[model samples]
Target chain A: MDNLNFDEPTRKELQTFIEREQAQSRYNSTVQNMTSMCWDKCVTGTPGNSFSRGEASCLANCVDRFLDASIFMTKTIQDQRARLQASQPETF
Target chain B: MASRKEAFMNTIRNEIALSNAQELLNKTNEKCYAKCITKPGTSLSGSEETCLARCMDRYMEAFSIVSRSYQTRLARERDASA
Candidate 1:
């Protein structure tokens, strides 16, 4: 990889481009995983021509609710850490 | 030099696109196989094939729906945090 001698600006450009692509790729993978999970939860019946209204709405809500659950869990952990640090301030 | 840089960027872009496509295909194969192939027969029956086709379509649709919902939620969270 070091054999390719790119100019500073070109290297920086490529670096940013790759970073953006990686972020996009990560976003795509999350969607794929959530789709599979929500499909199992909402799409119980055999595959029809189209999704029923209930199933479609359930799929949408499932994503939002899952994100909410993640945020809630993160906050809970942060709060627990804060409390622990407060109680044991000398443990530094 | 300019053309070399273009080629390098194109390679990276193509690799990402290929991997993304492969991931989607593998997932669809796993999911639809589970949903459609209830029993392993001598081969795939006609009804199972039909079901798999529909299942693949529905899975893609579901993916888009999820992507949109997640993007909207992420944007809202970012705004709130800001």
Candidate 2:
């Protein structure tokens, strides 16, 4: 594949296109995961043409809260690591 | 070489489309089966057919709602982080 499509500028273009596509693919999968998670939490009742007000709000809140929780946990872990480093002293 | 490249591009596009379609189909099947197949009858009845149709429509609606909600959240996060 590389040998067949070898040109300086064209190769650079294809590489960038591939990178963009890879990023989009990752972004898409994240969305898919979020959808599945939120759907399970929010859409518990029998399927209907319209969602009740409570269900709609739950769906919106689910996404925001999930992302918030993820960020908060990551920050908490980093903070704990920093605290540990600060507390431990090296004498050796 | 050009034809091969075209073929490769076509394959990628087709794969992406196929996966998206498969995802929709699976969601529809699971939701519809749950909603419509309440009782294992000798055959599919009229009410079950109606329920399955409505269920598919509702599933698509749920998909759109979730998609919008997530997209908005992503945009808001980007703005805040920026």
Candidate 3:
């Protein structure tokens, strides 16, 4: 491996390729994480041949609502920080 | 040089693919086992095998549903922010 030195152009190309692959891998892991989390929340009953309508919809909504909760919490934290900074200007 | 670059790229691609596959299999194993095997028996009974098979299919179906919903929400959020 030590003797394998890529030229400048090749290096740049590989850098972008690796970055793209890394982003894809991150996306995949996020999907995997949400799948398991939602499965636990939605699929409580015993396994059947197919999902009931209620279970299917619950699975879908679980994913959306989880993201919504995350965004809501982030906004709330930022708002709280702003209020604190505004109220205690001289604390710095 | 070109051949070496190709080899390197293929290695990275295969590694990522392999990891994603392993993660899915691990999740299926964990979830299906929990669902289908409520008690530890000396062996997997006939009904338990049926349940496990159904459970695996349903888990995968649920996974796809979650993936689609998440992707749609992400796109919507991106549009909103943009």
Candidate 4:
């Protein structure tokens, strides 16, 4: 609440700080999700003393491929939208 | 007061950090339990306990790996856009 009245510049600074923190938190949650997902997909065997060479690589590749897939899907959808607009220029 | 603003920002940062830690703990607990414990039992068997310990370690390792990969990707994308 307004328990602490922040001046205009201070408020703007705090807003920027919060936005940065939010971006960071979003990145962190994505990592958390990818970790859980890749752990399941890449780590099939029982937990050993340490990861095998293949397992380690698989974990790394999983994250990269997952992000690639996300970007690809977004691009695909945008392309589809562009195509639709081109085909139907007047359609709102 | 300037001190009050500093204190408020510190509180916000601390809360964010604490929540992040809580989230990691929750995910670790859920994933490790699922991986290590196939069936619910009155007590955790010896093998299940061992599996849980190893699973916890691996989960943390996986988190680090993903964090690294994501950071690398973010940097690459930023460089590309710039």
| Shift in Å, residue A77, candidate 4 | 1.8
Q: Across residues B19-80, which tens digit of lDDT does each residue of candidate 1 receive?
A: 98898899999989999999989999999999999999999999999999999998998999
Write down the lDDT of every candidate, Cα atoms only: 0.92, 0.76, 0.92, 0.89
State the lDDT at B17 in candidate 2: 70
User: How good is the docking of model 3, as DockQ?
Assistant: 0.87
The residue ranges of model 2 lying beyond 4 angstroms of the native Cα positions read B1-7
TM-score of each: 0.94, 0.81, 0.95, 0.91
Clashing residue pairs, candidate 4?
none
Candidate order by lDDT, decreasing, is: 1, 3, 4, 2
Worst 10 residues of 4 chain A by lDDT: A1-10
Residue B68 of candidate 2: its Cα lDDT?
82
Docking class of 1: high
Residues A1-92, candidate 4: write the lDDT tens digits.
25568888888888898899899888888888899899889999888889999999999999889989998999999999999999999994
- DockQ, computed on Cα atoms, for candidate 4: 0.78
lDDT of 2: 0.76
**Over the true interface residues, superposed, what is the Cα RMSD of model 1?**
0.8
lDDT (Cα, tens digit) per residue for candidate 2, span A9-86: 656756776677677667666766676677778878776677889988887788789988998999999999888888
Give the clashing residue pairs of candidate 3, or none: none
Q: Could you give the fnat of all candidates in order?
A: 0.85, 0.40, 0.96, 0.69
